[model samples]
Target: MNTTTSPTSTKNLVDTAAANGSFKTFGKAIERAGMSDTLRGAGPFTIFAPTDAAFDKMPAGQLENLFKPENKEELVSLLNYHVVSGRKLVADIGKWEVAKTVNGQSAPIKLADDKVRIDGALVTSADIGSTNGVLHGIDKVNIPTKQ
Candidate 1:
């Protein structure tokens, strides 16, 4: 998987994630949740996006259910939980005790031994720069409330 994106790339966050090919399921989720335009828009945003393998770690049937039209709001909330308002690279994120997600909930940030965990999901790759913001690849999907 491509871990770092060129800081000079003109592509926006959505496009950068798409180009990496590690975020297929996440890309679909963003599109299905109707958050594509926002993530692609101007102004910077920080994303702790789960890799496709991370989506595979979800409970059976839950991933499928999240994509249903009736569950759009839930999907949106879940997706929003992976994002913050500013461009926080790993270094910037490490300085914060907690991050306020787009979902309006705070996610605990833990940094130790040169590794970072956001809301319990370990960051596999970080500081992938893009035109709109940065994207960090995470190992698991983080639920708003631990379940």
Candidate 2:
């Protein structure tokens, strides 16, 4: 994997997420999880990035609590829930109904006449390209595992 993980690191998770206005919350979570370097490393990734409005859905102060220094593990798991191995584009998804995430969990892929859903969130934006990965803008964050 390529190892140049800086603020402008190629097309990996970090840079791609940062470029997307919808993924601002996801990007903040990545930084809070201290996963900027790992996600920026060159390995093709498909990230189901949640919008900033999605973060707002959480209970007041809940998001801040999740980002606490002591909650890093949970934050990491949630952020990783968005990533899949390789550069999977919207067209590549086709009729596929499921994709496994980097966190060792599966997110269901739902296709509709006008849109796609990952787990429960609607994919509002699809196929944002990057050098190392692709990103889809999701309306909500998926739970990594069982609650």
Candidate 3:
């Protein structure tokens, strides 16, 4: 079986995720949200990236709906909800009960049976470091609560 490993170098977040191959769906969503430039820009970000399988698990038609041009705002909001402004490793995440996302909302972190969960999604892979951030792979897609 192929295992996903974190990029150790200072590669940018977008490039790192693309190189990993596990984040193709997410990469597309990032582009659709017009967030490529932002994610590739300065300061560190902690992204809880959902794998392709995670996106697949979304209710049928939901992902398609979110991709619609008119739903851009919603898609962007959902994507932003998965990102925190600072680079946070697994250890740092363990120290917090809630992490504030770039979207201006808080994502609750839960520790149970030695597993870390964010917004009800399981953190399947942790601490994938990048040039501008770190990424954790989640098993399920996390949708931001409607404002």
Instruction: List, residue by residue over 1-147, the lDDT tens digit for candidate 2.
Output: 112323344556677777756677788888889888877877777788888987787779878988899988888888788889987777666477888888888889877885778888887777777777777777886877742
Which one is best on lDDT? 1
Compared with the true structure, the alpha-carbon lDDT of candidate 3 equals 0.87
Rank by TM-score, highest first. Answer: 1, 3, 2
Tens digit of per-residue lDDT, candidate 1, span 102-133:
99999999988878899999889898999999
Structural similarity to truth (TM-score) of each candidate? 0.94, 0.85, 0.92
Q: Cα RMSD for candidate 2?
A: 5.6
**Model 3, residue 108: C-alpha shift (Å):** 1.0
lDDT of 2 at 104: 83
Q: Which stretches of candidate 3 lie over 4 Å from their true place?
A: 1-8
* Backbone clashes (count) for model 3: 0
* Ordered list by lDDT, greatest first: 1, 3, 2
* Candidate scoring better on lDDT of 1 and 3: 1
The most accurate candidate by TM-score is: 1
